[model samples]
Target chain A: MVQALIGIGIVYIGILIVLSLRSRREIKSSTDFILGGAKIGLILGFMTFAATLFSTFTLMGMPDFSRTHGVGAWLFLAFSDAVMVFFILWFGFYLRKRIGQQSFRGMSSLLQDCYQNKGVGYLYFTAAFLFLIPYVAIQIRGVAIFLLEAFPDFISVGFWSVLIVLIMLLYSELGGLKAIIYADFMQGTLLLIVVWLVAFNCLDQVGGWASLFEKINESNRALLSPPGPKGLLTPQFLIASCIAIAMIPVTQPQLSTRLVIMKNYKSLLRMAVAVGTFAMLIILPTIIIGLYGALYYAEESTSGFLGTVLLQEQHPIVAAVTIIGLFAAAMSTSDSQLFAMGNEFRGLLGASKEDQLTPVRVAIIVFAIAALLFSLVSSDELVLLARLSFSGTGIMGPMIILGILSKKPMGSFMIWFSALALLIFILSQLNVVPQNIYSFRVDLALMILLSLGAFINYRLKK
Target chain B: MIKNWSERKLKSTWRIIYWSAILLIAVTFSPIVLIQDKVDPHWLQMPFHLWVSILNTIVLVALTGVGGYVFYTLKSKTDNDQNL
Candidate 1:
């Protein structure tokens, strides 16, 4: 199994290097490096966007969540993603129009132009750095843990974590964003294939889908219903999950960047629908794998359960492919993020065009190191941490929306309010402040208040 | 005034459909509001909640397909008119 995994890993890395070398010829300027020349068509756009949105957490966390939380896990991701797709459609239209009005390089610069204040750009970058670094760390941590479980004797989890980050930086430095997207197209395809293959394998082992659920019902009825037996998927929890997930295109820089760089609105629209379909197809398999775990490995630890299902019980070859798929998922997600951090850093700079790419490259190396350190100490709750990243960055969603939609410039006061709201949310996450007010989650409440303040401030100015 | 009103109505029609679809899906799948209990008549051996969630997914996907089709048709028409 280890040899097969290493062979496949070598091939994957070889392919990434080849793609980087091929794309490097096109890297004449910062714009070409950062935005893939900003002319990506429908098919590549859909695949890259899907790959970036769904990552290691979806593959590893969703099944574990479903196994523990019941079927409501479906609503947690698939339905929430559906809602997000709708928002992307509308938001993309407004965003494109806004970008047309004043061309900007990245989200931070776009916000700066919209508000006519540099502070807003800094605030956007601050929120992204605070929320997104840990999110990237969790992706690295997820794959590290999975690999450790698969081959405990191969190397330490830290080594795998370091290796993943190094690979991301190497290719990203060599080929830039074009290499990342092409790599994403390949990663997304492999993830979908291996996941469904494992999912059906689980079903076959459990007799079939019908009998699988029957076995689940017999053993644990809660796995079939809301809140599961653990009560993790309550209405409020799912609602909060929906809001956070829906805010991805509005908040997450990597995803929002993908939305902007598509060839045309027509392609964006097609990409939106394609992502919705992809969301359902990718999540369906996790449900099968989760239920299989619930039925058989109910008492096992997470590492133990996943190790058994993903490796011990499966054929060695399947296990090797699954490991490669996991690596692909992690790299596709983390590299996009590390690259986005570099892009956002460039936007923050006032440097000349010729001086931008080098500093951005240096900043990316710093970001990767930060993520590696965080991965070493990060929690194992992949889904929860990812959600926290979503809702934390969601603090800026209303700001972005108002910026895109409003004809007039927003006040500097709005940026202060956004900064304050983000501070409060971070405090709540740290438990320095309570997370709920009148039964509403702090992040959700802050989002609504800041959004209303944005609208009201705009109205009063008018 | 009449042209403005017609255009406004046309635009709001899609908004209305969009919101209604969202509401319908949210209501059907929300455990606190509906399907709070596991019941009989399971489809594909999935419980009622799971069944309804899948059903809602289908509806959402269909809605997405329709929305894409509408955009595609409108875009083509605008292109043709511009060419003329």
Candidate 2:
């Protein structure tokens, strides 16, 4: 197994290096580097989009989530993803029509232009920075801890985290967004294949789907229903989660940038459908794998369960591929996010495109280091932490949507209003404020308020 | 005159599909689909709630495909009319 892991790991890194070096030659300008020349076709666009959206969280976090939370985890992610892809069809059209293909620098810059205010741009960049760093951190942290468990006699978790960050920065800095997209294509394919392979094996071991569920029913019937044993998947929580997840493409820079960079509307639409299909296919298998854990490794720690199911229980070659797949998942997401932040920072600059690349590259390095540091200190509750990141960025969704959709010169009220909402959400996360107000989650309440405020502001300005 | 009328009809139909997709999403999250402890009426040996939610997701994705088709048709027609 160790030999297989070493062989496969070398091959994977070899591919990444080759792809990055090859992509580096194609960069003629900052736009080409930052936006994949803004001409991504259907297949590339779909792969990158799915890869960025589903990551370490999908592979490592989700199985444990389902094992603990039950089938309702499906609604929390897969169903929400279904709704989100449909939304991309609607929102992507309007956004592309407004921004055009070539003129888009980043969402921050676009918002600055729309509101004719720098504060909006600052607000957007700050919010993305605050939320996305933790997200990237968890990806690094997830893979690092898993590696530690796999190679218990290997390097420390912090060293593994730094190594991952360094590799990510090296490739992304060399080839830019194009390199990241190519890497994403490879990562997304591996993620799907590896997940389904493990799931099929688990299912077969459990004597197929019928017997699997029958065993689950006998062991813990709550696994079959909503609000499982822990009672966490309530209606309000699921609804809020859906809203947050749906808002992802609207507010998350990595995904929204994908929408803007597609070759055309047709490709974008096709990519949206493909992603929805991918979401269902990828998530279905995790349920089987999770249920397998529920029956066998139910009382085990997260790392223990994952190490056994994803590695020890598998063939040597399969386990090697799983390790590489997990690494791919983490890097696929972290690099795009780091790149997107750099692009957003570029968008806020007053410098020329030529001058912008230097600062942008510097910012990417800085952001990757911050994520590496955060990963060392971050918690193991991957799914909930990921949801917080989604909900946090989602606070800006209404503000972003209004800026894109409204024709009038909307005033700066929403900029400040969104800033306040973001502050409150952060405070709630830190326990400085209650997470719920009058039995409504503060994040949901803030989303409602921001949406309403944006609507009224639009009407008054018009 | 015929083009104008058909384009307007297409626009309206697109709007209907758009709203229906939204409505379907809302319904899926409601109590009807997410009913707790209602594990009967199993499909493919899966529980009631799980299968219903899965079916709803498939339906939603299908609706998105339909919506995308209608939107492209409406958009192309409008673009053609403008070109003329």
**For every model in order, what is the iRMS?**
3.8, 3.3
Colliding residue pairs in candidate 2: none
> Residue-wise lDDT of candidate 2 within A83-170, one digit each (tens)?
9998988898888877863467788988988888888999999999999999999899999989998999979999999899988888
What are the root-mean-square deviations of the candidates from the true structure over C-alphas?
Answer: 3.1, 2.1
- Top candidate when judged by DockQ against the true structure: 2
DockQ of each: 0.36, 0.49
lDDT of 1 at B56: 82
Docking model 1 quality class? acceptable
DockQ, model 2, C-alpha based = 0.49
Stretches of candidate 2 off by over 4 Å are: A351-354, B1-5, B79-84
Residues A1-462 of candidate 1 have per-residue lDDT tens digits of 888878987998899889999889999988788877877888999999999998999888888888888788888899888888877766877787677633346789888888888988899998998899999998899999998888789899899999889887888899989998999999899889888988988999999988998888788887787877877777777777787888888788898889888887778888998999999999999989999999989888777888889888777788888888888888888989988878888887864653468888898899999999999999888888999899889888888888878888877777888889989998998899998978887876887798789889878876
- Per model, the share of native interface contacts recovered reads 0.38, 0.57
As a TM-score, model 2 comes out at 0.97
